[model samples]
Target chain A: MIGCGWGLVYGVLNSLSNIMLLPSAPFISIRPQIALPMAVGILLNPPAGFVVGFIGNMIGDGISGFGIWKFWNWHLANGLMGFIPGLIRYFGIVKIGTVREFGILQMSVVLASGIAVAFAVLLDVCFLHHMTFPSSFPSWILPAFLTDAVNGFVLVPVILLAFRKILLTLEIRTICLVTILLLLAVFSTAVSITLSILDDLVSQEAVIENFYIAGIVSVFLLVVGFLASVVFVRRFTDPVIRMSRASQEVESGHYDLSLLDPVSSRNDELGRLSRVLQKMAKTVQERERSLRQQVQDLQIKIDRKRKDEEVREIVETDYFRELKKKAKAFRSS
Target chain B: MAKIIAIHSFRGGTGKSNTTANLACLLAREGYRVGMVDTDIQSPGIHVLFDLDTNDIPYALNDYLWGKCDIARAAYDVTKTLGADATGRLFLVPSSIRAGDIARVLHYGYDVTLLKEGYRQLIRQLPLDYLFIDTHPGINEETLMSIATTDVLLIILRPDQQDYQGTAVTVEVSRQLEVPEMYIVLNKVPVRVDREALAAKAVSAYDCPVVGVLPHDEDMLDLGSSGIFSLRYPDHIISREMRRIVQRLTP
Candidate 1:
């Protein structure tokens, strides 16, 4: 239920944000395709898919202009999209075994979500706002449909793929660093937006002054972000350099050194290099094992050769002694 | 510096991921340090080839994106999982499979440049001899950025009409991006199909080197993302073809 609630919130927020941003870039509008699956996954699993989507979407929507009342209805409609898909899949009405199957499921939910959002928008415009469905409904609907389809078909899969890729990479420290960066971005964006809005409500001179202040602040934040990222990258690179050095040492038969700690710093790059070193260490260990086996085999061969030499020496001594005794006896006779 | 090789297909189901995984594994077997990244974050599935269960994945690309973990922490070292004969190291950076991560990213969207930075970071930090990026099929910010940064770009396609057109688009994009080296890998060709003719036709059409023409192998389907195909069936025809592709990739 909480998942569904979160999905509802995310759906509404995602729809609202897309609507707000739709005027500027029609091709890049937000859609509920991702939110729907996310909501369903979250509602079913909690704090997994639904919560993130819900929180993200709500934040995005809140950034737009939906009122509390309208937000609730929007949430309900959006939440339904996720709930329906989950229920259908759970009931075995839809199968999701392969990549293709998953794609189809995403399309269906997205299409359904698009329809629901359209209805919600229509309700808001006609009944709530007391305005006619804009002369732009046809144009808007098509783009919305396309955008949602793209979101479902393209974006959803990409997200899943990225998720899977990240899991495989297993760079937790990078994740934390990136998260901090994103939070900073969000915080910076919020502050900038707030300042601009405040400046708008004030006098011209105050607005100008505020704009100047905000610009300076934005630049400072951006610089900080860049510097932090650079530091992180540098930290990441240091380990790779160390790992390479260690690898070179190992190549020269120095196996006592261990891999550098990639996560010693908050840099994502170093952590990745550390992983490579760890991998290199494993390869070195295997080589060491093979080398050990070869040495043992060589030792056995050496022992066998020594035994053969001892046998040859004994045979030679006996033959020579016999020959000498025969010659003496012959001479004496 | 490790050479970053990106494998892309214009259309879906062109065997991009499988080909990437196989090539990476084959290179690793030959004592090369190879890393594979499934940058198709929206629909990630390469972990299956590495026998990685979702439960086993503690971090992912989504986690990296959401600031929950470092990209390196997301890399799973599957070399040990592969076995004793596998001398090369294989680390996989998988995308998140969780629905929430997917939704949050789509709804919020992150900086495309950040993803590019992540790629460069992965290459430099991992010190990868080869970083294979299995990208999403079509052109996107991430795909274009990866193409722009890659040292070698391998475009995978089948002998289908749709694929031909799509491959042309990707080839053109890679050319426009001025990728240092570009090669086309013709995959899933029928056994009865004339290899020489296919290669010639594809080469003439793309005006690029046809690195390898791999026959459709039933063994791949039977394995079904269970493990790296080339490593499991080293002597198989498909694996042999994959080796040819790897040879071209190597200096």
Candidate 2:
């Protein structure tokens, strides 16, 4: 029943994607709804994701009055897209805890699109009596792969974030930023490449194909560079974030600072700062304990030293001296 | 030879006279010939510890200080006042408690030298081993005289902030006088006081050794300075501390 319900919703999303047709490519549409089944796959189980994707794509084609049986391989392709990402569940990633986990989540999305599209192109080559390499590569294969990968990479995390399964830790934040920036870089590269193709320089098939290959290479480079920067930022900023949190703990008078052990071991300036803060907090706690005991001794907080001085002035007078002398002399007698 | 022991306080209600009475009584009970002179002529209260009525002081220290009678005539044999348990003799030279006479002595003050001289004569005349002077509270001429002439000086003070200031001054002044021995006796201390801490504080603050810390006893409050606390409740803490004081003063 769950599968059927999601399948209907996926079908609705599929038709919705078709309504917003791509402006640059004639047959292609902005299929952000492709993320629905992929996200479900990672969140739930693979069978559920496969059912949703296959049935939903079938319903979508049926609603448009297309021959669902004629293009049955595309439905299978969509099901494979969902089913493969659901295998991330077997990686035992209960949640996206680190930048690496988030990177894997996104990598799996694009990988699923690559595999599913390759499978469809393969089926067309052998069974459907069409060589997809030169013909369908431009129209079907490239369009489907690029659109699904890009859309799923950007939209799947958003869905998971909204579900609160991916906690916004420092690592997650860095990964999210990398994802957004990567999307922008890829989108701009794609637009320029498409514009170049439309610029009358596209008559050369080899040049257009080289540009397509360059665009794919640059996207990989952008993703790699952004992920490397995430690691760089994490190495530098993680200790600073930990120290700031430790400072707050000290301000609240909680001096147990075993939390900074990793930060303190780095031998960096941040590590020195962590060690200093831990020592200072312990010293302050000891001083406060001693001060509390001293305070307990003096209930009224009297200025006994000053008062004693004043009393000495009052009693150590000329007459008191003379009298003491007289008595001292008298005792001698 | 009698040792002149002056018990003085910088403030009143420190149980000074009671301490003197107890020390003198305990000394006499221990077979030491002890004589206590009420040199606190202005506010003499040592006689009350012995239940010695003002009417019974036939010839008071006032008459002796005023040259109206010999100082020995004023010294009353008060050992029997402690009842049959008292084994040795004790003498107390009481000050004039008469209303007219108290006014007279205050108005026409006697010489501090005369009180010093009288202490000597009473010690020799009574032939006492110990002559205890119960000086009046505060830094008056006669009290200073009594403090200065003493062989042993025991300053009584409560564990009070005000008393701390004065007790410090008293210890300094007594030290200046070159008394052979001096000690502090903390009196009327609250029950919860850390006694060792208080003694250390007192010793460090005043530069004097502390002999005893007498906790505030309910029985002492009940007695209200009318009778000797050590005699009535010998086993009580207050009495026990008084005995310790006597031991310290004697040793």
Candidate 3:
């Protein structure tokens, strides 16, 4: 009963969100609601997610006046989109607590989207005879997969994080920050391309010629910028990784100075960090050496003192006095 | 005759208590009747490594030292703490960890003669093959007494300068006492340090044989002296080294 109610609510919401398309970019509509059922599935159970997604899509189609079975394969695709992420939880990935889990969640989302869309298209080809493979794939299947996957990937983490299911460590923070910036860049470039094509001032011929150039140039910039950021981030992250490894070595008493040389030589913040770490390690090593020397010296001093104390302890005794007298008397005899 | 071994270090945190506990457990595991006495009354921690509850201890080494109870009465059968079936029995004479007991022991200081007698009584009552004494760090009156009475003196030290100097003094003192067998067990040695070279250096420094050179082990650190490391990680390199040290000490 609860699952059916959730499905009904989600179906209505999906229909409402689908009706609201961006004016500037009609074809590339924002469908943030798709990730709702996916998050529900993951947090609850796979079947709950499947029921909500499948029933919701069917109800949504009925409400939108597109006969419930008009796009039945697509409804199944949506159901699978919710169901696959839920399996992550089912398979003992109950929380996205670490970098590895975070990676798995993202990859699973993308993979599930691809598989579901491919399944839907195959069903369409087989039963409905709607898709014509090569021609229709670019127009229909590609967009469906990209939109759902991207939406699910972007939104599921946000919801999970809000629910305190995913921990935000330094690594996750860095990745999220970079991803948001990249998404902003892509969103703005796409909006600009759409606006350029829609602008009335540009003649048809001019629009056709310059729009292609603008699109190509923006795409080239995006790729180059993405690569540049990745490299920049790597410079900082790589040293941190190495420094952490070196720190572990120090922890286990493997104070080999050579382990830190590569990082210490760099001329950046991480280089400074490496230098500081090396200094700390060196100080600790020196302190250990000095500590041993100090203890050894103390021991020598204590040994001398103990010998004196030992002699005093024996001489103070009556037995030692008797022995001394006996020795003197024996010598006299 | 039951062999009495006093494991001491000049400095604290040299894994003295940990090594003593591990050695005792391993000895017992090998089907030898082993008994351990925590002589570090000021800071009785070896009991924790054995997982002995303070509340359960009706009589402690302090009680025996104060003549409140017999040494055998103070000894607890700690074989169950090892979590294994031992053909040979294991007993522990833990010192009182109570704050008042610690302060009292430090302030009044028990008779070294009585403490030594208590150890002998404990061994006799338990019928132990070996009795291991975990001593307080540094040379004190009680520590010297324990050292004098023990058949073997195992001086534990880290690969550090402070330990080196302290151990030198201990070695010199023990030599004067004429301990039958004195061995050095270097603890928390770094991985990169050449074990052979360090052992050689230690041998020359004190004219004592280096019985074991244990590497700084993460598992040991993680265990945090809560339990015996050697018994817990029998196949670990540190445990292997510990077993080797035991072999040398036994013979």
Q: Who wins the lDDT comparison? A: 2
Candidate 3 lDDT, B1-251, residue by residue in tens? 68889999999999998899888888888889999999999988888887788767699999988989889998888898667577778999998888899999878987777876787687778889999999999887778777777889999998876777677777766665667789999888877666777787677767789899999978788989687887778899899999998898775
lDDT of 2 by residue, A113-190 (tens): 999988877887777854446875677778889889988988899999898768766567666666667666777677
> Of models 1 and 3, which has the larger lDDT?
3
Taking the candidates one at a time, how many backbone clashes does each contain?
Answer: 62, 0, 12
- Please state the error at residue B7 of candidate 3 in Å: 0.5
Query: Which candidate would rank higher by TM-score, 1 or 3?
Result: 3
Q: Residue A145, candidate 2: how far off, in angstroms?
A: 2.5
For lDDT, candidate 2 versus 3, the one ahead is 2
lDDT of candidate 1 vs native?
0.66
Rank ordering of all candidates by TM-score, starting from the highest: 2, 3, 1
Tens digits of per-residue lDDT for model 1, A1-333: 565455466555565656544433442365644544543452353233435444445555565654435444444444444444444345443323343445345555566567656765676675666334665465555565555554554444344444442221324345446746776777677677767765555578877787788788778888998999899788666766787787787788766455465343323444555666666677778877776654432221113344345434533454334433433232222
Write down the worst ten-residue block by lDDT for model 2 chain B: B168-177
Cα lDDT, all candidates: 0.66, 0.80, 0.79
TM-scores, all candidates, are: 0.42, 0.49, 0.47
True contacts kept of each: 0.00, 0.38, 0.00
Better candidate number, 1 or 2, judged by lDDT: 2
Ranking by DockQ: 2, 3, 1
